[model samples]
Target: MKERNHTTLTEFILLGFGSGLGLKEGPFVVFLVIYMTTTLGNTTMVFLISANSPLHISMYFFLMNLSFLDLCYSSTIAPKAMMSFLAGSKSISFHGCATQLFFFGLFASTEAFILAAMAYDRYTAICNPLLYPITMSKQVCIQLLVGSYVCGGVNSMVQTVFTFTLCFCGSNEIDHFFCDIPPLLSLSCTNTDINVLVLFTLSSLIIVSTSMVILVSYACIISAILRIRSAEGRHRAFSTCTSHMMSVILFYGTLTFIYAQPSSLSAPAQSKMVSVFYTLVIPMLNPLIYSLRNKDVREALGRTISSVFLK
Candidate 1:
């Protein structure tokens, strides 16, 4: 048993880019731009999906929720991170850190499940088109969405309680931009074997399970596409899923690299770099990835612009 002084830690100093990472002004400006892009892009996605009647399907419903999640995801970490760089304000209250960790977990977990749900939607649409409406009915979609959020909330609640309850008698410095589980676990003075195990277990359960759903969904989707007799039909079917495939690959790849392994095997700089990708870059990229490959989105955007300008 490790001896801990049991002194209450009311706050933590975030050592985000504080150890001579780079000039503050440059990174601050870049992050500001990234945050703004994330906001605008995802907000536009949500609006376009919601306002356009043609886009009112299970796929677009999932996409709208995805955009909302990306917006929340980036907002959770980017604002504080940008502030840290520009304002030189690195200290965060204990409750504030907990809140941040909770929302970060909630949104990230929800997005993972939502991505799986989207994969499932694509699978049903392509693999079982005739049954798509019945299988992915409006009621079912709402249930899936609500279930994802609830599971996310539960995961965050458990993780937050586990993290904050750990004894922090030593340094209160968190070596990342936000209060993520890995960094916070490293800051604990008490024995963290349980915490680490819990983090890894819960993370694996959510990530691996959802990843399996995606993998299985895509596998079926591809098989069904291959069975199509016409080349044009095959292309059209596969095209609809490409955007989602890219999103899943980018999101799951980075997240797996970070959470799938224990922190001991990861260097702080390397970990932070990976974290920045999923937390900031990926959110900004998701809307672009979906829209650029999606004809419906392009046409809708053009129509919206034309309608507004020609009036």
Candidate 2:
């Protein structure tokens, strides 16, 4: 028979909003506005990508997936976070917390892999223009996306299982807004060496693997750009990947701050702020970065808006 080391945690109290002194309506309203914007922005990107013929390529397909993930990901926490601010009760049940952690990990990791896939797409499009369509065929694109999701699913399953295995006989208050693995692990009464090692290993794999792919793809892209003789061509080529590069930077930077370290490394307040960047700010920024900065997406949105209004 298999044995478990720690008694399982039944529930966890979330320590959202840090301090609840006079934060009655303002913060709630602000988050509500932010959540609404997140939904609208991400939804618009998905709809535009699906409806526009030009955006039916591999790059836009991945962008649509990222948009979908961002929308659902933000929905998971922002509403509840706002509710916690208003209700002054930050408690989340054991099952509920686990559920949150599962989807959160699922989407966050998926985004990392999706960004890597997008980089590969860009690399093929620019570095091997003749073979772009052949290399990024429909079947290949589907597999890349499906593989990203599968990676996320497997990682989430392992991390979530190991996370919930810890005994929570003592404090239930999670020091962050959500049921993150780090903060939850910090509160466990049992030995978490295995969980910590597994988490660190899994996170390292995701971060390093995707970062390496992005770096290699960009290296090829730079080589292609340097070979082009026309200054106008170079500018146009570089502009194509600008928004995607920005999104990658924001997503990876925030993720590194949150997961790529031991809990002992960060102060509570600093951790909370970094968490807010990945959870709140990055999701909000991604759709905006793509839609506003990229002319093709902006034009697609305009056409969609006109068509809908005309009907």
Candidate 3:
């Protein structure tokens, strides 16, 4: 048994999806395409919601924020991953890893809470249409947005501080593409019992609490929808939530599978595959799902394009 000071470690070899898989070069092209689509799609969505007056309500407001987050956090991961591949260098500096982890956690946690807030927005809109405006007011919306970001920032700081504080072995080779808790934990030379505890505990606290909010809100919403007498009314009511539900399933499902389990890093190959889903695929899919499913978004997009062309 031998070791060196974690401080002496200047860089980490990010063996993304292992050494012999040939993932670095082959996936570069695919990830580049996905990253482009994610950027274009989310940017278009944010612009569409902001520029249009009709999409100014609570749901779209949350959606716009979600798009911005997806754009931001996806940029945090994808560009770095692609750059490392392009440079043909697996080494990421200590500060770079810290920065990547911070922004990734910040946006990811914020997006979790934002999804919860969106669920509550849907609940208010569908369950209590009469008081929807009063309940999810502009002031309240701002408060929720600020609260989500703050909570996420706090979580990010905690994870970053604790993670970097740990004594890592001299190997400095991370098993995955990005700097994540589980993979980083695998690098620690010291006992990581407390680290693992904090990781899973915070993960559960954020994921479960937000998930409960989404689940409970949707439950009440379902009850309210059932109470509607007209078939068209029920159908229309459920339609508003369908896109959010899909986003929820995809986003939360992957997150929970990865972070919610403490032993996630144990299965490096599987975790890396799933990481691709949330990191690359989900961001790319969100706007497509929303715009394709929701009539108002499609109509708004159409009108925006038409106005652009007419000028």
Candidate 4:
């Protein structure tokens, strides 16, 4: 067995999507458009939730957090990716990559917790309507929001520390777009068994536990809805959950596929596309999905537009 040198690598070249794809300026333009749209959509959602009195509730509170998370999450990766596409420079400094990984992990883990909190909120609202206000009080909501961030921060810290500690002796070209765990692990010259174990354990705990919360909440919500004697009541109750459910499915489905498997088994191309969908596309879709499907949001937007025009 040969001993590996622990040479300090200062920077890494992110071979984003690779030149072999033959994507010219068109993809850059498209990504720019998506980034702008994602920013606008999420910003609008946050603004609407904040400004509208009708939306000053627990559900919307959680929603506003989600919008903010999406905005930050997309920003962490999109701008850098777009710049690489335009400038044909794929290099990212060691610290720059670490920062990206930290924030990306932070927002991503926080969003998962927020979704679970939202599911619990829905559960309370529908299943225990009489106690909903007390169950999801202002203090409780604040606690939930704070807890989500704290959990995310802790998770991000652990993963970032574990990842960057590894020795990259020779190759510094990252196969994917951003600074992610799997690709980084693939590049490490030293043994990564412990890192892989920690990655799998932490990621699985976050995803599976939060997913279970959502599943149980929805199960209870459904049971309560089914007991509603009025068809209109049942429909209305179910309608409130549809948007969150869809977002959850889209997010968790992609994330589980990408992160749950060992890095050695992941196909770089397929993983990149999946990453694009959840990281970029999902953020843009979230606001649209919620606003377009909910009449209240549409009315609120209309009111906002009319107020500005009338002024």
The better candidate by TM-score, 2 or 3, is 3
Off by over 4 Å in 1: 1-7, 20-23
Candidate that would win on TM-score: 3
Per-residue lDDT tens digits of candidate 3, residues 247-291?
999998999889888677687899999999999999999999999
Q: Model 4: how far is 244 from its true place, Å?
A: 0.5
Residue-wise lDDT of candidate 1 within 232-288, one digit each (tens)?
A: 999999999999999999998898888776763358889888898999999999999
User: What range of 10 consecutive residues in model 1 has the weakest lDDT sum?
Assistant: 1-10
lDDT of each: 0.89, 0.84, 0.91, 0.90
Q: Estimate each model's TM-score.
A: 0.96, 0.94, 0.97, 0.96
Give Cα distance to truth, residue 186, candidate 1, Å. Answer: 1.3
- TM-score result, candidate 2: 0.94
Candidate 2 residue pairs in clash (backbone atoms < 3 Å): none
Error of 4 at 221 (Å): 0.6
